[model samples]
Target: MRRLSGVTIDCAEPAVLAGFWSALLDRPVSAEHARPDWATVGSRFDPAPRLTFQRVPEPKRGKVRLHLDVEVDDIDEARARIEELGGRWTGERHDYPGEGVVLGMTDPEGHEFCVVQYF
Candidate 1:
């Protein structure tokens, strides 16, 4: 059996990226696993994998294939909150009647993610 341990993100600033993700996920950054160049967040009763951030020297060149999908109760509120936290709405939205809505957004580090709300 394959046990999914964690997902590591290559970033320029570990603490900053970790902080953005931590607030968005409503979880605390794991101090024990954090370092000057690496930081971890999320892992409390959540069956999903944890998130780790590692410091990298190079900037992201192209688009990211793997990004996060954050589910929230309200898309508008979440968008506002994300914007308040330095993230921005990408002006792209998708709607599925009787299903849900997906709002595209970019994090402080320019990583794209989605805020989803299901009916």
Candidate 2:
């Protein structure tokens, strides 16, 4: 069986961007990693894969190709929490007759990800 360990994000500041994701996902960065170029957050407890942030010299351009779909208990509450942690809402929402709602958002580094609530 193939197992996925985590997802790596590319950004200009690893520590700063990692902070936003660490708080949002409720995972602490690994103490073992002392390198300033990389940071990681996540644990086996998390239902999804772990998150890793790597330092890059350039800022992101245009839109990201991959978007993470995060399932939340409450869309509005989750959105609020994201902003409180430094992320912002994209001001876009999609409704599916009986499916549920999806809210678009971006991380501090402008990586696109979605908050999903299924009814």
Best by TM-score: 1
Per-residue lDDT of candidate 1, residues 1-119 (tens digit): 56776788988988988889889888888875747998988763457778888988999878899888999999999999999888999999999999999999998888888999999
Candidate 1 to truth, TM: 0.91
Q: What is the C-alpha RMSD of each candidate to the true structure, in Å?
A: 1.7, 1.9
> What does candidate 1 score in Cα RMSD to the true structure?
1.7
TM-scores of all candidate predictions against the true structure:
0.91, 0.89
Task: Supply every candidate's count of residue pairs whose N, Cα or C atoms clash at under 3 angstroms.
Answer: 0, 0
**In candidate 2, which residue pairs get closer than 3 Å at backbone N, Cα or C atoms, i.e. clash?**
none
Distance from true location, Cα of 92 in model 2, Å: 1.4
Query: What lDDT does candidate 2 reach at residue 85?
Result: 82
Model 1 local distance difference test score: 0.87
In model 1, what are the clashing residue pairs, if there are any?
none
